[model samples]
Target: MRKLIFALAPVIAMGGITLAVAQNATTATREVYVKARPTDVLSSNLIGLNVHNNAKENVGEIKDLIVSSSGQLSGFIVSVGGFLGIGERYVVVAPSALKVTYSENDKKWSATMDTTKDALKAAPEFKYEGRWSK
Candidate 1:
């Protein structure tokens, strides 16, 4: 029994080391980004931003962003036809629909769409429920 215990000790220690190496291999598979590109815009700066039309009319306010599982931007939730949040409803728009720009002189970000407030209000509304619940 003493000899058997001594024989298993090295195997048990090797198993623990193998388990640790496996854990490190799993961790290394996840990608890590260390630097931000110039085109990257912080999501914190986008929320609550007023969306305007080409005619300089405020169409909607950016309420939320939808990100896909593949790490891509899926949609932008815009609130339209709201009077101090009383009658507002959320509408999901494609990220390409909004023309987002940054002005170097004013150091401000602006978003514009070739649409009107009435057009946005007439769009299909998105309700916060289930997976998108507030």
Candidate 2:
């Protein structure tokens, strides 16, 4: 009984130490916000951005980013052209398609797409007077 009590004492002490340590641990909650500088933000580097069409071709590059009145990025204004920027038409792309990535080899930013250029051009152009969401 004495030997058993000695062994159990150390085990009980260890359990107490563990409980004390656990009680002493502190927990914190933090909030983080990620914002990009207007100058640092570029239309060319957005990821998963694409111009898609029912015919499956990418038409052109995104010309500008549109934001909400509350300052959140809403969509992309894409410019599609066949003979350079001269004949381009503008379209809006959903923000879901855009992602951001870094490239070590090129040492520059690039945008990737799940859709082709031809497909993008095939999509309907945004009418100047109408909301893109429509």
- The candidate maximizing TM-score is 1
Candidate 2 runs further than 4 Å off:
1-59, 127-134
**Residue 76 accuracy (lDDT) in model 1:** 82
- Cα deviation of 119 in candidate 1 (Å)? 0.9
Which lDDT tens digits does candidate 2 get at residues 1-134?
A: 11211111111011011101011111232212224433343434543244444344554566666655434455667776656556777767766663334457977544444655655668778755657443
TM-score of 2: 0.49
Clashing residue pairs found in predicted model 1: none
Q: What is the lDDT of residue 1 in candidate 2?
A: 18
C-alpha RMSD in Å of predicted model 2 compared with the true structure: 19.5
| lDDT tens readout by residue for model 1, 1-134 | 11111111111111011101111112335322234445556677679889999889999999997765533466789999969999998899887788777778999878888898888889999999998888
Overall lDDT per candidate, in order of appearance: 0.68, 0.47
Worst 10 residues of 1 by lDDT: 12-21
What lDDT would candidate 1 get against the real structure?
0.68
